[model samples]
Every structure is written in C-alpha cells, then in structure tokens.
Target: MRSPTPPDEPRFVLAARHMVETGQWLLPHRGSELYAEKPPTFMWIQAGTYKLLGSWNLSFLLPSLLAALLTLWLTWDMARRLWNPRVARYAVLALFVTLQFGLMAKRAQIDMVLVGMTTLALWGLVRHLLLGPSWGALALAAFAAGVGTVTKGVGFLPLLMLVPWVIWRWRHPQAAGPGRSWKWWLLLPAFLAGTAVWLAPLGIALLQNPDPALQSYAKELLFKQTGTRYANAWHHHQPFWYYLQVMFTLWVPGSLLFPWLVPAWWRRCRRADPRYLLLLGWALLVLVFFSASPGKREVYILPMLPALAVAAAPLLPGLLRRTGVRWVLMLYALLLSLATLVVGYGAVHGDGWAQRNAVKRAIDPWVLPQVGWWLIGFAVATLLVIAVLRLRRAGLAVVLTTVLLWCMYGLGAMPALDPYSSASRVMDQVRERIGPDAELGMVAWREQNLLQTWPQATDFGFKRPVAGQWEDAARWVAQAPERRWLFVLDKVMSPCADRSQVIDIGSANRNNWQLLPGTALQADCVARTHGVVDDADAALQDDGD
Candidate 1:
C-alpha cells in the first residue's frame, strides 16, 4: 500500500547506494550480461528507500516486504469474495508462512515486487469485473496494473487473465457492470499503456548504457538461464515434473492437501463458480508460460502461490470438522517447535559465530540454519496464531499478521546469514596470506562480482568473472605466489598437493552462495575455493594476455 521503510545501515546496501555514490548506471557489471541484471524496478525502489533511511540494504527489502503484506491483505479480501472467507484466511497464511515466497518477498530480487504488483492487479481486476466495474474500483485496478508492469516484465501477463472477464465487461457493460458505460474499453488499453509507461524508462536506461556485459546478461536472464544447454541433462534442465516437485518443497505444510484439492476445486468451479476456474487457470497459465520459456526454476511458480493457498480454504474447514481444529493446530505447533530448535542450534553451534564472522562476505546468505531457534519461534507464533483462530474465531487477519511477521523476520536475518557461510568468510581469511601489490589472478573459475565483499575489489572495479580457457586460468593461479593474492572458485586450482601446499577456507559455498537452494547438505559444490596453485606457472584458462 505504501513504500517500505528505509534500512538504517548504508554501507551494507549494494547496488542502489552504488547508483547514488558512483552516479553510475546499474547496467555495468562483472560478467556476461546475457543473463539479466538490471535492478530496473528494484533499484528504483531501493533508491527511494535509500533516500528515506539514509541506508540501502534493509531499505531495499522494505518495499517488497510491504508489497507482500499488501498482497496478503488483498488475497484475503479476494478469497472471501471469490470463494469463501476460509479460503481468504488460508491464502494469506500460505503466502506469508510458506518459506519460499516468504524468503523471496524479503529479498533484493525483483520477483517479490512482481508477485505483489501482479496480485494487486488481479485483485482489482476481479473486483471490477465481478462487481460491475465501479469507477473507484477501476481507478484502483488501473493504478495497480501500472505499478505491476513498471516493476517487472512478467507483470503484463496477468492482464491476459482478465481477457475472459474483459469480454464480459465490455460487450455487456450497460447490462453487466455497475459503471455500465463503454468504460470497460479503457481497462485493457490502460493495462497495456501502463506496461509501456513503466517499461519505457528501463528500456531507455539500458539502451543508454549498452555495454557488452549487459548484452551477455540479457542472453542469460532472457535465454540461457531459462533452460539447460545440455538439453536432457537434469543438472541444468529439470523433468516436466519440476512444478510437481516444487509444490512439495515450496508449498511446505499446505502441499499435504494441495493435490487432492485441485480436482475438487475444478468441480466446484464448474459453473458452481467460474472464479475457481479463474484461479486454477491463473496458476495453469503461469505453468505453461514458464514451461514454454527457456528458463525454469522452482521459484518461478511462486506467482501463483496466493491463488493456490486461497483455493485450499475449502479443505481446511473439512480438516477442522473431521480431525478437530485442535489437532490441526497441534500439528502446526509441533512443526513450529521443531523448526525453532533447528534454527537455534545452527545459530550457536554452526561454524563462524564466535569470531564475529557472521557475514564472511557482503552478499552470501548461508547462515547456519539456526533451525532450532526457528522451530521454537514458530512454536510460540503458531500457538498464538492457533489460539486466535480457535478461541476468538479470529478472521483471516490473524493468520495474515502472523505470517507477515515471520516473513519479515526471516528477510532481515538472511543478510546476517550470508556473510558467515559464503565467499565473504573465505575472503576474510585468505586476503591476509598474499603480499600487497601481488597480481591477483583467478583460477579455473572466477566470480567477478559474486565474491564482491566489503573491502573487496572496487579499486579494480567490476571485471568479467568467467574464464574462457582452463589453461589460462591455471596459469593465473600458478603465477599467483609472485607476491600477489588471489581468490578463485574451483578446487582445480588446488589439484597438485605436492607442488604447492594450499589451504581451504570458508568451507563450501558459491558466489551468491546463499541463493542456492537445497537442504542443509555438507555442500559439495556451491562454495569452497582452494588457496594455492598446483604449478607455479600452471594455467586453468589462458587469455593469451
């Protein structure tokens, strides 16, 4: 509903402050731009937050957090209107409590904004179409559509979801809508216009700062990153069953009933209510949209979370009726307690706490899972939430408030986690080993900006991180002890134990190590770089420079 509060810390904030301090455009970067890098909308939000808080990082996260809360608020209203009050309650809970959406909503990424904006538009559109396009409603709908489009490219797609209803509103406006004018004609055009308006600035900014890297980023985020190059290789490409798997992991507790509920939903919406079809179709269309795209990740399905959560409402009541609400509440309470234990243990028992090495890097979020603390916290929170629902007959508002509180808490904690477990930790230990003025060269792998830590390489500025030749990279590593210190991401740099006695630091993690998702594994690949070279002049990749 409103801009998020600005973060109090400034130096810790990344791109937006870079924009302010350097007055440089956001486009310039460390590697190939073929992926997608423009904070486009996110940067702007952060910029505003920076202005307000005089700090950048937390401020950057604020807008998305706010957007998520609003989305929860709207989801409750929409669920109540489209289906039942119970559905609204679950919808908000699902969006807020589910780890996946909760994590993303509080991050620096653009997807959270997209989710919130799109949900906002969907709410307004549904309200207008079903309740007769009231002018006041139309204005709200149009404004949200504009913000959504401005926030992300995917924002435009939701407008398509309105096509069926647009037809209903347009053709039979006099008989169909409350405003009852030809005004429905303006709705679709207004949506498109907003897309154009929002995108125009980003399009220009990118064009103005057209560097080679941006082209590479576009290729990746736009093309290569979408699909695996090896085609059938599961490493890069997933099975068609990917989304099915996503539901189990990302949806968490709700996934238990999700599959069975879908068919029931379809039957219920079969003229029993067309809106059920709308919600189902909304999720289905997003699946097809992503499936058809070259890029695929579990998080992509998040946009549909709100709708799916709301749809689960009918089943919750049944669960309450069949098992007794207390049982349902008890199970959640157990889950919360366990989660707290796991999180708490990780916080105290994990690797880097005593040294104040909480954040080894500026960007990594791999905090010890502090699983026990989370479990305990969840126990307390869940009990409170359950009490409100059971004792007070509390509206969905109670569920929503509980969820938003936790999501925001997790978001804030993530940055603290990143430093201890990522390259930042490794960098801190190894930077002291090499002599000053040593030509720091990368090894078989390079992370240009991925390893960007505070006191990192701003002096040299951003360099293209990927290596084109293994021999050259090895050479870079081998020439390293020539009085220069270096950081690389591969163990290949440490191949010869006898040739050079190198050490490992910061454990295993990757650039942006925290972003990599999976269970608490021992970490074979995401992070961990060796500190020495196999040959004094060996090369992992050769640039011939």
Candidate 2:
C-alpha cells in the first residue's frame, strides 16, 4: 500500500494533473504567465503515467519507484566494479535499508530521479577509469550528467567527482590505463549534445511563441532559481551544519556505522585505491556542494547515500566480526525499542506529549488505536536484531531492523497521518459547501492539496487587489458580473469578518480555511478602503477620481 502523500507530493501531482487535463505542461495555478519552477521532465513522465493508468493515486509514485530501483542497481554495479561481488552485495543491502533512501524512494518526488541519474553518471565515470577510458563510457557519463541537469539543476554537481579522480590519475600515470587524454575531452561535447535533446525543443518553441511568460520561465530556470538559491535563498534557509545534523539522525543505523568506518576509508584513499577514491570523492563533493548552499533540505543530500554505502562496504566484514560493533548494534536496537514504547504510551494515554512531538502531532486520533501495531513491529525488529547478531549476520541484522521499522511506519503510521497530511477530507467539505461547479479562488494562500483534489477549480492565488493595481485573477474577479466564491486562510479572512459569511473548512500545515462569497469580499474591500480614507482625508484625495 502507498503511504499518504507528503506535503510536497501534491504540488508535483497538481502540476502533472494540469498537464493531463488541459494538455498544458506549465503550472496552471502559478498564473498563466508563470512556468513551473523546475524543468518539465518528471511532471511530463507523471502525466504520461497518469494517462496510461487512468488513476492519479499511484501514477506519480511510479517514476519514484523506477528511479529508486535504478539507483539500487547502479549502486550495486558500481560497487561490483570497484570491489568484489561480496562487497557489492553488502553495499546494496546497506543502501536498501538506509532511512533516507527508503523514505525518499517511496515518495512521489524528483529527488530519487536526480539520485538515480547521478548514480548512473558516477558509474559510467568509474567504468571509464577502472576498465580503461572507452568512448562509450565517457559518452554515457556525460549524457547522464546532461539529462540529470534537466531533471534538477544540481544534477551536474555529481560531475565534480571527476576533479579528484583526474587529480589521482595525474598523480599516478600508470593507473590511467590505455585511454588517451583526448577521449576525456569528449565528455563536454557529449554532455551538451544530451542536454540539447530537451533544450533544443524548448528553445525553438519559445522562439516561435516569443511570449513574456516563456521568457520569464527561461530566466527563472536558468538563472534566478539556481543563483538565488545559493547566494540568497528565498526559502528553506539553514546553517551549514544542517546536513551534518541530518547525517546523525535522519541517516539512522547506517550513520551509527559511518563514523567507525570513515577513517579506514580515507586511509585507503591515501593509498590510492581507485575505487575508494572515486566513492570518497563522489560522497564528499556532493555533500559539500549541497552544504554550501544557503537553502538546505534533508533530502538534498540523498544523492550521496549510494556513494557512502560503496565506500563503507569494504569494512563491513571486519566490523561485523568485532564484539564491540555487535554491542553498538544492540544498543541502537534498544534505543529504538525505547522510543516505540514511549510513543505507544503517549498515543494511548492522553497527554500534552502528542502536541510536543512532531511525529505524534501528524497522526489522527483515530489512528491511536492502531499504535499497538507499530509497537509490535518495533519489538519484532529488536528481537530479530538479537537473533541475527547471535547468528553473526550483522549486515542482515541491520537490513532487517531498518526495513521492519520502515514497513511498520508505512503500514500503520502513514495511514493514520493521512487526515493531516492530505487535503482530501477538506476538499470534500469544500465541495459540499459550494456546489461542485462553483468557481473557487484562493486568497493569500495556496495549498497543494487543493490543486490535487480539485484540478478543475479556478485558482486565484492571493490575487486580491491591494490599491487599484490588478493582476489576472483579481482583474477577472473584479470585472465579472457573477458572484465569486473564494477560499481564504483564517489569517487573511480578518478583513472579511462582517461582510462575508465564513464557513470553516479543516486545517492543514497549521492554516485554517473558510469559504466566503464574492459580494461580501468586494464589500469588505470597499469598507476597508473607506475606513482607511476616513482616518486620513489626504490619503483619500491622493486616490484620484
């Protein structure tokens, strides 16, 4: 079963829904002139899937799942090329159970696609380095980079791993193999050629149209989004240490083993183990690149996980044999069990703990009854850890423990959290309040749930006229003879208090919504203006006739 759609899923789904419904690839709610923030590759893929499946439910997730599988396969292949088959198998197991990978792989997002593409690129580069620089491998690597670039701007960032690899190659000329230096130079042209596959069509279409909206999209995609995110982030701003914190917590059991194994990996790198150097370079470059960005999200570091897994795979055998490592694994399992107990207690007993805990707050009261299942899962995982440790199957213990926990969370916790995480319930209420066909506009807030639930509904998107200046939806609403129905957040509804009859819809993301009539909204706007004018006569005079 699929888990509830997270906060960002609806946004991508909405965009894809628009493409399917209206045959428009751009973001419909972002105004007619505004293009989507990211390239249309993922959305287009989602649209195609939705079209084929005739169901929106699993359509978006299909791409994510494919990307995840590709990532796993590529990681395995890279590990195999770099080390032995045994190490490759261990690396795949380690990667499969990683918390970040498991969580992201299940989501309907582009992050996994980016991860998959970068992994492919890294694999291609490693192939060229280890098996001699074949033109085919160089082209594959460069093309992956270009395609990944179109997927997300940071796709090109993985190519930076080549710097360290090149440096190492120069230091030890004998390791350069039979490849000529000129073959390496072909990587640039191949990348540009691959990129042009998408860019060429888009550029021609823009030139043929030559509209402001298309131009705006081009500028934003090429410059504003990338430059602004790095220099001065508009959203999700965090300190450099943000990812460091994520490594410790969000990375989970794998992270517990990372610190123990990293020193050895680095020592191997110094000894010029080509595989170690490649994996190390891939992980460090990706991590440092994302960390340097002012805008940070835990998911941004996902591309590094495969590389880290490969780098750490070599030490798994020795580490598993150590008594101390087994003890540490046991301790980790105990902590997980303790957490499950505390959360289960909090779920059953009415306490302020639910309010204080982020995880608890996500679940609906109805789901509390099912909390026992989650606890059961944790207990089973803990017991399995002990059993596996006893059998000296340390790697299997890690995989089983992590997978069991995530499976339980997906089956029990996710469905329970659906009420808050999704807007389906709220949209039903909205439809009941306003007849299904009534035009709906949003003021001062945009909810992804709204778009996903009701794709056909008109979106005004904070288009309330401030002075006399009017935008698209505001201009249309103002001029229309028919009454308009709008959805406004509680915070923005204060101005319409007496003029409009506000019917409370549900809340999500800490914001409440109310359905309001258009006549009341107009009256409120006029009254507010009149009140402002009454306070200052000079201000009224300046408003002109």
Candidate 3:
C-alpha cells in the first residue's frame, strides 16, 4: 500500500473506483469528465478485480500481473507446438527477461492485457493456419481479436497474421489452413461476438439514453479515439524510426542478440521454413503497422515482443554459445550495474546529480538516501554475480541481474517514491492542514488528486479551461470562507491569490501544489484568472466604453 499508482495508472484506477462506487460499469469517468480515450474493457476488469479483492491497492495491479503470466504461458505452449520443449522454455525466458515486457507487467495499464489477448489470438491462428485446418481454432482466434479490439483499438493487430499466412500458403499449396468451406463466414460473427461482450451493452445504453453527452461520448470513443487519434495524433508525435530505436534500447539483452539473430532468421526464411516465415513475417507487420503512425510510445509496439521471442527461441541456445554474443551480454550487465552504483553513491553522499534528480522527480530528501543505499547494495551483489559467472554464463547472469534489479526497485525504491509520485503525501498534508471538518475543493486538478482523496473532495472538472475552473473554484470557496479550502496547482493559480495566505505544500509529480484559503482571494480576482484579460486591460476597455 505504500506505493501509489503511477502516471496513467491512477486514471484507470479512478475510473474503476467510480464504477464500483456508482454501479456504472458501462461508462467510465475521470474526475468530472467522461474518459473517452479508450474503451471500457480494461476498466471493467480492474473494477471486477476491486470487487473481488475489496482492497484497492492489492487488487489494482492484479489483472496486469495475471495477464502477463497468461501471455508467457501461451508463448511457451505455442513455441513448443511449433518447435520443441527446449525452444518453448527459452521462448518464455526470453519474453520474461525482456525489459519492456517485465516493466509493463507490474503496472496497472491496459497494454499488458491487450498483449495477452493478442498473443492468444496469434497462438490460435498459428495452431489452425499452420498446424491444422481446425475450424474451432479459427473461430477462437477471431473471437480473441474481437475481445482485443474492445480492450484497445489496436487489439486486432493479431488478425494481421492472415497476411503472412496467405503469403506462405501461396508459396506452398500444401500448407495447412481452414480450407474452402461455407463455415468460414462464421469467423466474422465470432469476432463480432467478442466485441459485443462490451460494445453490445454500450450500444444498448446509448440507444436507450439518447442524452447528448452520452451521444458525444460514443462518437468520441468510437471515432475520435480510434480513427482520428491514429490517423492524426495530437500528442506524442515522433519520427517514423522511433520504434526502431525502442527495439534496440527497451528490448534490451534480447535485442542485443538481434545482430546475430537477423541473419539466422533470413537464412531460415530463404530455406522456406514456414515457422520462421509466419512468425517473423507477423512481427515485421506489427512493427510496420505501428511505425506508420506519427504518434508513438514505447508500449505501443509491445505486442511484437512475443512473436519475436518465439522466433528467436530456437536460435538463442546456439547464439549464447558464441563468444562475441557472450561478451556483449556481459558488457551490458556490467554497464547497468555500474550505472546504478554511481547513482546510489551520489545520492548517499548528497552529490549534485542526486540533488538535481531529487528535484526533477520530486523525491523526498530522506527517502533518496534510503533508496540510494538499496541501489548501492544491489549493484555490489550484481557485480559479484557477473564476476562469478564470467563469460561462460553471461546469459544466465544477465537474466538474473535484470530480474534482481526489478525486484529491488519494486521492493526497495517504489515505496520511497510512492508518496510523492502518487500524490498521497500532498493529499495527506491537505487533509491535515484543513482538518477533518473543512470542505476541500480542487481546481485544475489531475486524476491523482481526485483519486487519492475520493468522495471527500470536490473537483471543478478535469478538462475545464484553467480560467473557468479557477472562477468556479474561487466562487465555491467564497461562499464559505471559514470552513472551505481550495487546493490549486501552482501553474493555474490566479495572480490575485494572495501569496501570504496560500501555503506551499511542496512539489509532487513535477508540479508545485498549494493549499489556498478564501482569505487569499483579492478584490480583483475575478478579472485575473488565466487565459483572460487582466485587470488593467479590463479597466482600459471599461474607460473607453
């Protein structure tokens, strides 16, 4: 419970919390606005988990953890069927040790669950299209694609497996497939059925309600979030080659072997190995699909990792025996160990690097030293493991080092960082300063502020313009000066806020938050809310009139 939800996790958690409290599972909300960025499938799972466990902190990340395990298991079984038991074991290990996969697994995000669904779909497709003409497997694959669609707009990515399957079949007429049959049409409906699990209910509610806000929400969710957002994203714009960079860095040790694996994959493909053809082909298509989009994030390409790992599994054993590959792996481990030790040592000694980062990440002074020691100790142990294993077992040492570092960061560092990152510390202080009986209102607030202090604080609105939110909040606080208080983000605080009357509650999430009382309001507060003309402009216009 010590670690708070990070970044987008709080947005999901707040929506799920609203679902549990209001019994509105069909629609999700973040603060006072409708959360239309993604579909409700992930939130539904999170809400269900909350109900089952009844502990928000423990249950929040459970779905992601379970989905990650499911993805690994499916990858293992698929590799075994296509290759051998040895390849299967290596496949799971490769995926589990990959940097991005493990990081996404521990967070309360939709990507991991989406990856699970997509992986299942791919496995089913491989089973039917490559191994058998089984109708059931085809239908299951279609259904999974549909479910994945509702989870995230790009969840249907696995269905792109058909492109490679078709090409492979064209090359060799004897390839396994569902064959010519009228039952092939059933695949479409099966996929629709999976989507209907969530969309059907949503369509029904939209038809029954006809409220304009609900109608607008449906339009935004179905069209804007999926189509417009993909075609012309308004944020996180990056160059087309961005995901290639992600592959080299975030893919880590697995990617470190790409230099050797690529040639081996080409030779297999040239020899017309259908397994490599389908797996590598699908992985490439996934990369191309996301790379075509202007807006990119590291997690957007995560679905490709499983297919890449499965294809590389057969080659990993032989590659690990190579001296050059072993050296590269060992060098990576050593560098990571040294980097952690340096950061830790600086933090413990109150060096400029540590102090600068503490301000940048909003880390508490005391917490930094404690976490620094943990990092230093972990680095020492990791260095010793590398030395003992030497080049002979560099692969094993890298895997062990990666796993141990994640564990240490999760157990040792996260708790210390949680209070500030999650806004728990800020909310706790607000409660303490205002006392239990005082009503609290929030202006220009984030999802974290409302989430950490739910049912007890009132927010103007999450997406409201700052000036409007300030006007509404100041009006609210003006009504009851003694018993009411306003929590404001420093960036949006009106110039009219009396500095002497506002209490700086310190910084969290890189933003300074302040607790403001009604006494802080100046006479000219109405004219000076952000993005509006100031008092001088208003007076000039009034005098001219």
Candidate 4:
C-alpha cells in the first residue's frame, strides 16, 4: 500500500503512502481491514522527515528521540514550577522511568504526540494561572489543547481539568486575578485553525473513498477506544481497580517514588491555575469515560498516566518532609529495582515463559526488554538514597529529591526503548524465505503491511502475509496448493509449540516476540512448518494445522 513500510509503524507506512501519493492527510482508507489503509497524521510528518533526512529507517527512532527530549525538558520545567527545583527534579525522574511511557514513545501512535501536547498544555496553563494569563501562555495552552483534539478524541479531558480551576479563580478574587486583557481569547481561533489545518487533509481523503472499514476504525479508535472502557470483555475482564493494578505492575519506578516525594495541596490545586485543575480533570474525566465503554484495553488509559505522573512529581518533597516515611520510599525503590531484574531476565532468558506442551504459548515476549541496564537503574536508586542522606530537614530533602528525579529517569528507565523494532527483523526473515511470485496472506494481527517496506519484501513465497490467523491461513492455503504459507500469532492466540510437526525456525515465545534462541530479531516470533496436510481436508481450527 506504500513505500518504505516502517516495519514497526504499519500505520505510519500507510499514512506516508497516502501523503506522498496525494500530497494530503485525509484519505478514504480504513485500517484493520482486508487490505484497508487509512490516512493518518503520522505519515504527513514522517514523509516530511524522509524528505529532509533522505532516510526512512530513522522513522520510528527520530520521533521517539524528539518526544523523549521534549518530555524531559518540559517535565523539568513543569516540576520546577509545581514544587521547588528539588521536587521538580525528582518528579521528572519518576516520569522518565515509566515503562509504559517509554513504550509509547516509539510507536507511531498519536498518543506520544499527546504526551507533548499535554506537557505544553501544562506549561501554558502554569504560565496563565501562576503568572497571570499573558497572551503568550494562553495562546500556547490553547494551541496545545486544540492539537490534542485533532490527535486523539475525547477532547473534553483538558476542559475537565482547566475550566473548573478557572472558575475557582474567578470566584476567589483574593486567591486569583482576572488574567490579562482579551488577548487570551485570541487562542480560540489559533486552536481551531491549527487543528483544522492538520486534520483537514485526512478529512478530505475520507470523503473521497467512503469505505465502511475506515468509518469503523475511525469511530472505534476515536470514540469507542478513546471514549469508552468496558469493564468486561468476552475473554479478558478485570475488577474496578483494573487500571490501578495495571499501573502498579507496569509503571514501576514511579509507583515507588510518588507516595514519598509529592505534596498534598495538589489534590485541589485549581486555586493556583484554572489549568492545573484542567489537567487533572482531563485525565480523570477520561478515566470515567473509559469505565463506561464496552471495549477496553490497558492502553485506553495511557493518556492519563503522563498527567498523573507529572502531577505526582510535585509532591515528593512534601512527602519527604513528613519524617520516617522517607525510608519507606527508599525501600520501595529497592524493591522496584529487584522486580525489574526478575522481569527483565525472565523475558531475555526464559524458555518461552508460557509452555504447556504441543499447543504451547509464549508469555515472555509480552514481558521483558532485550538488554536491561539494571546496574544503571540501581545506581540511580543509590543516588536517591544519597540525596536522602544529605537532607537535614524537609526543605533540604525536597531539594535533594528534585535533583535525583531526572537522575533516576536517565538511569532507571530510558534503556528499555526499541522493543517494537523487533517486527523489522521478522520482516527481513520472511522476505528472505519467501520468493518472487509467492502471494501473501493477512490473518490475525494489524501489522501486515509492515512487511511490504523492505525492497525484497515483494518477492514472496507467501501471499505478502501479515497478521493472519489459523482459520484464514488454512482457507488461503486450501484455495491454492502451490503457494507456501506462514502464519503469525501472539502466544495467547496460537500456541505453535503444541503441534508435533511444526518446524520452528524462530523462537516460540511471543512475548517480546524476538527471534529464536541465539539470534537477534524482534519481529513476529515467526515459525515456518511445512507438511502434507491435504489442502481439501485440512480443518480451519486448532486441530487443522
């Protein structure tokens, strides 16, 4: 569907194709379809990047690097304003080590962009509320929020956060002042114009194709995926504390540091800025919004984490000022460091963490990073302890915590990037095995077109296969006896190890989806098993393959 398939970013690949082909953002292609492609904003920028840089290989990494750097800078500034430089440093520290945040940075999803927008919103709101609304701050805040609307739906989040705080300020003249002249009002037009300008292209494209799949994915990702979160799915369900539990397990470093370093006033901090209240409201409103949806995934709540993490950072010094509880914080960091080692080692060394015999499954790929910097993370923890040692009083502890914050992020969290790039390796392997004239098949997953990026990708023995399932694969194989077949599956979906005759050229583990033992490819945890199952007689279920 496009040139330069961003092996890790199939969505961006499709979008880039549309951008280069039509010189526009809006396209009538619905993703998650049978050969369906939707035009999105990623390609518009990615295409521009390719032109300026003359390389598509940097696609995923470049944007991620930018997101990270900006996040660090913005977070530092944000923490400084919320607390002392001490708390700000520690707050930024905790944010850096968030694993989910790192993962989001590398994907082609608009969510990372949300991170940037959210940060800018915080900065602008802080300026508007703390220092009084100068035109610059209001305009910046407006621009950021407006962009968020175009990028991810449920635009009411920021409103939930900022509006109430503004009202609070309006009601309390002693605590707040009416911001500068009508200049803040100018932001509304800028917000509308900026958002429309970027999204207008995609809108135009949709009007042209009018494909149902496009409408469906758009509706689901924008409204259902973003708007609603069902407590129960057919197979996967969780308790009300589901998001809370997920965060505890996944957002390791932050969980350890948040309770000890943050202050208490942040609970109703809207008195300071209509914007701070707006940020909190933005995050929580989305939380309640998801609770009402029928379809839910852990990622549905991703946007909320950044705000909470940033907000929590400002409290570290306040918590430390309370006395003996600071030791509890150190203990938590120690426990976290150990947990990271266990999970990291399990993923890198375990014999396919989920193995139940012939119909085996993989849990490791879903678990670990390839090369962890345990030593570095621990060193950062040590810094936190040292910082605590230097603290003679609450105020001193606050100062120490702030410096250690960013130190922790750099050491503890930044190394686990690049796990998604594993797919690029699978694309290479599949291309090497498949040859000219082989047709590809689409089965279970969403990243099918990811394979098409490689120059040799088109020469295939399979039908340009991507994310196909057992049933769909069996049907494709049955229709044409001559073309070879390869099916890709995540551990839960298809346990290839359970079969007696299947040949595994790569690892069976689907978690982290790396190549077989000894090799270094992270794509598709692919396996190729050929046999003489009569094409006509082969079943489409588990028993068939």
Query: lDDT scores for all predictions?
Result: 0.52, 0.70, 0.84, 0.49
Listed in order, each prediction's TM-score against the native is: 0.66, 0.88, 0.95, 0.64
Model 1: residues >4 Å from true position, as ranges? 1-14, 26-28, 31-39, 80-91, 135-150, 163-175, 178-189, 202-236, 292-295, 311-319, 324-329, 332-418, 430-452, 455-484, 490-505, 508-545
Clashes in candidate 3: how many?
0
Per-residue error at 81 for model 4, in Å?
4.6
Cα-lDDT of candidate 1: 0.52
- Which model scores highest in lDDT? 3
Sort order, TM-score high to low: 3, 2, 1, 4
Candidate 4 residues 80-161, lDDT tens each?
7665687667666666657677666655555676667666766776666656645677677777777766655533245445
> Over the stretch 248-312, how does candidate 1's per-residue lDDT look in tens digits?
87666566555557667867766535466556666778777666644456766777888777666
Clashes of each: 67, 0, 0, 58
CA-only RMSD, every prediction? 9.3, 5.6, 4.9, 8.9
Question: What is the TM-score (0 to 1) of candidate 3?
Answer: 0.95
Residues 1-545 of candidate 3 have per-residue lDDT tens digits of: 45446567888888898898889888898877788888889989989988899988887888899999999999999999999999999999999889999999988889999999999999988898888877788899899999999999888888888888788778888755667788778779989998998899999998799899999999998998888878998777899999989999999989989889999999999998988988899988988888898888889999999999999999999999999999999999899899999999988887868779887867768887898998898899899999899999998998899888888878988777789889888888888888888888887676777787845488877766666667777778788878888888776667778888889976777778888887677535655545652222221110000
Model 3 lDDT, residue 12, Cα: 87
At residue 506, give the lDDT of candidate 2. Answer: 71
lDDT string, candidate 2, 115-195, tens digits: 998888888877877666567886888899898888887888767877887788788887755446677778899898767
